[model samples]
Target: MKTLINFAVILFFAIAFNGIAYSNDECSFNGIDDVLYFQENSISNLREITVEACVKVNSFSARKSGANEIWQFIIFKKNQLDHFNEGFAIYLDEKNERFATSVASAKGIQAVIVDKKHSVELGRWYRLRMSANSKEIKFFVDGVLVKSAPTGFPLDFDSEELFIGGRTKILKDKDFEGRFCGSIKNIKIWSKVLDEDD
Candidate 1:
């Protein structure tokens, strides 16, 4: 009887801890060609959403595109399109030294680019979170509110697959656009907008 009780206690604690971890939505990434893809029916008709990630940049440099150098960290992307104006993504623009969060709605591509006074340091871990509702979207870094912008319209997309660490190839010319050069972990996505308490 004592052994049975001890086993039950262990099982209870294990279940409780597992539930906590699942609610946190933790995921780790290798930051190379590594990508996480979600099934088509996993999420649909999202009115409000939140995405969070803890990331460490391994390097900061730009890939040459003719005369221009583009340095960016493609954090998250949903849907496929020929250009940046066709989908939703949250990325770090190293060339501009800012965080760019964009959503392609029926109106157009609405983006909020927040410039940081200090450049992000490589090899250091930072927590980045973006929350969006019908009215506005909020960007947070390390638990501090960094920027907020009008959402413009409801976020609607037809793509069934969601990509992490890089974007899905929309155009052949843009295929190489979203390769991140760092490590990402503890990625979480929520269907509803999260507030301070969440």
Candidate 2:
């Protein structure tokens, strides 16, 4: 009976290990040909991302067609920018034309980090955390909140055919123009706002 129990224990261990590995299936969209993608159909945060081709997107926002459809908390220090200066951006090309949302700075008010202030910091990771009901945008670098936007900004919209690694031409019409270049990862989407408390 002891030997039988030992065999059962080993079998259970094998099953458990496989289960852990299976749970690690995060959403992904990479390559030059790649265009757009949104993890959730509605506004939620498990983690969402908006990035370019040949890059990885780890975002809590879902890629969508309208404004604020994505979970990307963009930072625009200036109006016009060179490709190299083009940081993370998004826009809506349809009916709703909105731009310039409100955001706050945090942790030393660091310049475009994770990419270069605007672009995704090379070989770096970023996390965007927020609440469901509140308009709190927190930017995290390597799992740290370096900057943030309070609330009542450009405001979220409804659209699809979204763009990553840069904004679509229509976005330019709204004033958010720039094709971002770099790598991205870890798109988390949550049902409600997740912070130190939750």
Cα-based lDDT for every prediction:
0.56, 0.29
Q: How does model 1 score by TM-score?
A: 0.71
Error of 2 at 112 (Å): 13
- Ten residues in a row with the worst lDDT in model 2? 1-10
How badly does each model clash, as a count of residue pairs? 0, 49
Instruction: Give the runs in model 2 whose Cα sits over 4 Å from its true position.
Output: 1-34, 38-40, 44-121, 126-135, 152-155, 169-176, 196-198
Candidate 2 residue-wise lDDT, 111-138, digit = tens:
2222232344333434433221234444
Off by over 4 Å in 1: 1-32, 62-71, 79-86, 169-171, 174-176
Scored against the true structure, residue 113 in model 2 reaches a CA lDDT of 22
Error of 2 at 63 (Å): 20
* List of clashing residue pairs for candidate 1: none
